[model samples]
Target chain A: MNLTQGTADPRPANPVRVVIVDDHAIFRSGLKADLGPSIHVVGEAATVEQAVAVIAEQRPDVVLLDVHLPGGLGGGGREVIAGSAALLGSTRFLALSVSDAAEDVVAVIRAGARGYVTKTISGAEITDAVFRVAGGDAVFSPRLAGFVLDAFGTAPADIADDELDKLSARELEVMRLIARGYSYKEVAKELFISIKTVETHVSAVLRKLQLSSRHELTKWAAERRLL
Target chain B: MATIPVRPPLARSSDRVIAGVCSGLAVHLGWPVKNVRVGMALATLAGGAGLVFYAWLWIMVPTADEAARRNARRPASPIAPAVSQPSGPGAFAPGIASPAVQAQGAAAADMTAAPLPGPPSAAGASPLRGASGSSTADAGQPEATPWFRFRSMKYGKEILLGCGLLLVAGIMIAQMLGVDVPLGTLIPAAAVLGGASIAWMQLDETRRAGLVDKTKADQAGGWARLAAGLALVVAGVLVMVSGSGSWEQTWLALLSSVAVLGGVVLVLLPWALKFWRDLESERAGRIREMERAEIAAHLHDSVLQTLALIQRRAGNEHDVVRLARAQERELRGWLFQDPGREAGQLSDRIKAAAAEVEDLLGNAVEVVSVGDAAMTEAHEAMVQASREAMFNASRHGGGTVSVYLEASEAQAEIFIKDRGPGFELSDVPEDRLGVRESIIGRMKRHGGTAAILNTGTGTEVRLRLQSAGTDAAEGKP
Candidate 1:
């Protein structure tokens, strides 16, 4: 759980501002209690409409979002991210859900969520992921890594290099290790690299998953409804 | 087959023709009913003896209803089973004791019993009409008046009657003007018109009923009526053309053409019915899709949120968390999965295996499978080895175990890992067969490879196998 302590800075004087956007009141309160003293709960929302409104009003450093919600075009978390697009630069969204659906994970990411984490994640890890997302770093949980691998992990010679649709060799290694439940620190140690280098590879893969225009990637994602 | 202690008391069966006397006697004597009916008819025709005997039997024997009441009081006599007569229509006696049989008899008596759900005018037009029309061919129930006669009817029936009257009036006026009218041609024409109108009414009735009940039996029954009506129309057409006294050669040609057209309609009728049913099912599916979102919302609001809360509260309690996780997975599968698509092969297997491991060890096992191969011996070995590796990870290497299985057309690979104190394979005792025989040796025997690696902080077991049909790895050994 303290895998990121060495890389992350000490808790600053001003706690990281966060807004919880889950439809469950019990989950929201439980998460708020488990988040410890390092994070400040600014606001909460249970639906897409309220999420957008609260995110805009609070202008929190990070927004913990549930992937499925009740209102706003029925797009759930994606609609919220799209609605709060203006605030994305200042207020990043870190999707926190109990759903492991690839389509939902990819949809929120494509709509500009910085990362996605399942609710099974421990309070310490979630708190760390929030800090990282707020600090403009991509947070890849093991499930998200698996999704990225399914989308981009392929043999090198099979696809032309010009497409840039597949993960790099190093990125593939990072994703596989993560998918195998290795923390970034553990992955770095296994590969004889620094945790910073591991983060860089993961962030690159996340970017490709979000903005790739290659037909193969689009076709692959579309086939699975990940797009 | 088993002989009863007592025979069914002699009584007139509800299934009666001419007071059911002959049929009841035949049933009591276990003789063919047709023999009895014929003998009675012959005796009556010859010397009036059958009439006197019939009158005596009719007075002496109780009706079926009274007999049923008598049996109810006694409770010792076994009710007679329904026996279908070998020859005569409506000769079978339905067992009065069984409610199911009674209800079936009632339904057969009135095929149009179900209330048609639509406009009041349409509903009122046809229940009795359909009953009478179907009864002539279907149930052999006696009718007070012949079904063909125009009777007190409404809506569609009145429209049909009005049209018939108008045609008759025009023909009468033409005849009055001293024109030679072919009345023979008008008769067949009227028959055709009547049959066509009957068929059209049946179609409308079926379409309206389909909206409410949507049961297969109802639709099938409706189609049968429609077919009967259409047959009548075709029969009328054949009669008019074939019965012409003059122009024999022309009549023969027209009859051949009509036969060909009839064959075509017969072939197309089934196809048309199928197309109509497909359109109906598509509309049903669309309606279900609309309701799906509403159901998803309601489930997500209460059940899903509760499961999520349980998982969150049971963070470190592995058993509670695993139970919650399994439930959530099941709930989500129900909520979003389409009706007929196959759940993926290796992924489903791995998830099932993971669930078993979680149940056994109370440790979470995260599994993800990419691509899929046909389930074969090689994939079976992979799953077994994966399960073994996962079991080892949960027992020895603690914390959450992660399993990643990637299957391609040529090969399949699996990685089972756990974050525990790293241990070397050489350090394991020789007595331990779980890793040596089950995980590593199992893959090797299946023309595959396995490796156990120490990841400094944890242990990982990797297994790979070639697809069964593919010979890509055959040349290696």
Candidate 2:
């Protein structure tokens, strides 16, 4: 696997810059309170309206955006849903909702969220989402990940159709994660492969199957349960 | 427009005016009851309309209050016993006859109480006109007060009106469409249809439920009545306009105009309201009946089945009674929108239940709650089943009681898990109600089913809800 510790951007140096935008005040505060001095909560908002404003002003690296809201500012009213789509440079929105409703799961992701997770998600998982969204990586709750895969009707490189018949376990894992829409670099890192090596394996995969693009590849892999 | 007298003291029905609550408040309070209602209505308008009071009265007061009152004015004690039971004409006690017959016999009995809402002092007064749409708070108030007893048919009011209105509207529309028939030509049909519909609602419930089925016959009767009335009026018109045209032509022209006017007035009026409301009553009554049936079916499948299983397995234990107690609470909840007998809020109820069931069965039980459970069918089932499941898991499975409740318009599900020994299909105990009655029976009744699945380390019970039917059949295969 390719691993790199790129030097931290000096401009926002040291502590991770986080902004919590969950509608649940207790959850948002509890997260901030639990993360302790390790992470900085630059700003917080309880609803989409306030979240947008907070993101615009604070410009934190990560925004813990709750997918539900309470009492005004368009909690789940389908308004201002598009409000959080465009974030200032380097800032990312993470979805925090109660259920992994497909519409909602797809909405936040389509709205340019870094990740989509449910409130049932664990504290560790939530902390992971913040970092992943901030770092331009997609974070999804396990069920929510299924919803996203369902939403686009596509899976990542390693997974797709033909599972009922046969596929090696390793091949299955690779196909499933790839059908999940992971980037080549991400997939290679996850699967512990060198970039060139990943390219070679991908070429062998394409040639052995005669598939054209990654889209068809993911669809085929999903059909076989290879991923 | 006819003035309707809605049960008085329209504002703040905190305390019913004993005869004068309305008038006394209107007097000592210095405002007419009607005026107070109007102001309260205006406030409802000023704010967002659904302040709660208006919606409260709409369903509380029956539509035909005036007619009910007229019935109430009859001499008392004669029909009291029968009316008290709300049955139709011939209901017999116990071994005597069917409930339907008894109910039918008792049908006319309610007349005394039914008519009492009408003011005792307003006996001979002209019928009052009720306003059409109340402010938000007053949303469901009936727009018209019905007659004490419709000497005219009350049930047919709507169809007659609708047909008349449609005809009048059709006539107006035809006129609009450039038809030669003038507006006056449509009026008679409108009035006849309208008048007849209002006339029908004056009939009894058997007639209302469409159980009587003589409505079409009544329409014929109405037609005969209208024809006779038209004949005389036409004859009079002919004598007056004699020599203008042949007798046949004069008669035709006269009758046609009268028919049109009659249809318009009768159908387009409060008279038609009785018919319209009867239609609604029939529909609402059907819905209530369906809901009752649904509750009964679930109670049978879930609770009754569980009881049967308990009777088989362990005979009857303390836990069985506790489970039965929980089931009773659920049944009461189904019957009442708010069973004031509830000890605590829903969350507290579930929480305490989780703790109690765990202790009872000697297992760990936990509850995770989201969304409100008030009145939602899913919430009721989830809470009830979870209570039962907790007992089952603790008593049988030897695992912590875990229950999950979820609800949405399109779907609802209750999932439960308990950790202990896994259920063996081979060791099926004779008296195993936990599996039979609590889980399997309940979901089946709701058009859903329950299945036990292996959850790696423990056993999980999943109840999948069946969505609406009829609409499903429309889907192409």
Candidate 3:
């Protein structure tokens, strides 16, 4: 199913610019071929060093990242995001990797990536994820939401004070589900509410916690061990 | 008698202090008993030449009983003329013979008349002769017996000391009886007696036997030479001190004694050096042999088995290449590469194995390890079994596999858990050898345990290897 289809594409005139970072040459070529005309492939890299250089040089609208790569400071995908920290506002990152490991998902999301999805997603789904990330939205695979939540759902014990207690009960449930890497559709279904209602609750939770995005909300919650 | 046959001299059984050689000779030569004894004693005082002669006669002469037995065995042989002739010495004074001597003569006559079956046995009859004969035979075949096979050297020294004391007693008795023995002659006689006894001790049968074995001979000869040199030095000092002479003469005597002792040591140096060298070489050879055996065992257990597996799967070119590459890396690291730097931590080794399984089965594995454990042979076995369990999980469990490792000084435990449908242990097909041989069997061989528990949620393979005591139930997840 195309999870990102319902979202609006802000850059329709200019096809979403993308740089694919993966260690496997075959997977890079296969992903480029599958994206077709809907998305524009600007550049590609096989290592963290090359990924940072290519992303900075091309200034792609969205970078499809792999969670594990061999060289260049050795933090895998997190190294690439941290290396190009100045470009994160204009250029977004969406992690696409073969690993479904909770640590890998939490690690990349905490490094300012907009979304995380396994490599098992269809070509249409991946294209939609790239457009949504370019449009300033967070996307995640269904099961991976729990890892995100467990990693960053609440403030740590020392910081678990008035800010977290300000969130309403409904807003708190929506915040936990979204920080856990759940899609808006998943959070709405789990809480028996409308998608619009889920989004409203998430916005309220973010405003109360003074967080900027779902990625930050997840990190803030994880530091508090709320999941 | 019509004819007289010449007979070899025999030790007479009667009138014997030790072997009766002097008494028998006195009888045969028709000399006065007192004259023969006095003459021999005087000869011993002159130079100890008489002692050497006595030792030789002791070896050559057969005892009276042995001689008689030989005669009886050959009845047709002509009898000795001396036997037919009446006792020559002391024949006129028959009353002087002791009752013991009469009894001995009667026993000898009775033995002569009996027809014995074999050649005359010298050593077989006398305990002394039996001991001496066996020791000499042992000396001939040194390798056939241990070095300490006989304690004869110690006993021989005791016997010599007794002989020297007896000579001293005789001198005292002679002086007390108002015989007026010259002090000059008595002193020389005592020196000669002591010298002869020391020389006799040098020919000990056990020492001769020790000389036949290289290691034993070196030790025995070294001590013997040192003792002899020290004795000679002491005697020379005594002689110089007793001689009331000039200081220049005493100085000359001391220099000669030191020179003699130095010469003896110089002669023994090469043999001692050779023995020391042999011992060192033997120790080195033993160490080399042990190292070679250890390397062979390691190759047989790991590398050789991998090579055989590769050969069997030649039809599958990918598996063959993978197996070949892994074996090559392992062998090269073991043989040529220095392990000091690249000795992998246990967690790293387990992660590497997991990577290999992932490549083989095309599945993702997450390895979570805590604590750095000393990687020993037992830990190696545990790692190998954990790899097998992971492979089985990826292939059959049909889901992402998770490997957890907890290691401490007391034990190392690895858990390979898969979030797939669990099955009973008995449900495994009979033909499948992966779980049975690779995981369970490997753990058991390492004095450890492998338990497969179907927890209803997922299958967990727990491999535990203890270093010291019974298994601990901690760290269960």
Per-candidate TM equals 0.58, 0.33, 0.31
lDDT of 2 by residue, A1-227 (tens): 11121212112225678887666677877888765354689888776567667777777777776655653533341223355445534666666765323334344444445555656455655665555445444454434422322222222333543332223344434433433333345556667775444434433332223222223233323322224
Q: Model 3's lDDT to the true fold?
A: 0.59
Query: What is the per-residue lDDT of model 3 for residues B165-271, given as tens digits with 9 covering 90 to 100?
Result: 78767977897698876655556456565655455555553355343333455555555556566566666665756588764575567579679967885577567
Q: Lowest lDDT 10-mer window, candidate 3 chain B?
A: B88-97
Per-model clash counts, in order, read 0, 101, 12
C-alpha RMSD by candidate, in order: 25.0, 22.9, 35.1
Q: Quote the positional error of residue B248 for candidate 1 in Å.
A: 13
lDDT of 1 by residue, B105-212 (tens): 333223333342211221221211210112212222221122111112214555766787788789877977988788657657766767676666666656644532
DockQ of each: 0.07, 0.01, 0.01
Which run of 10 residues does model 2 chain B get worst, by summed lDDT?
Answer: B124-133
For model 1 chain A, give the 10-residue run with minimal summed lDDT: A1-10
- Highest lDDT: give the candidate number: 1
Candidate 1 docking category? incorrect
The regions of model 3 sitting more than 4 angstroms off are: A1-18, A21-27, A33-62, A65-84, A87-227, B1-370, B376-381, B398-404, B417-422, B429-458, B465-471
For residues A30-134, write the lDDT of model 1, one tens digit per residue. Answer: 999989687999999999899999988999989999988888877788788889888877888998866544556676887788888888888898888888776
TM-score of chain B of 2: 0.26
Q: What is the interface RMSD of candidate 3, in Å?
A: 45.4
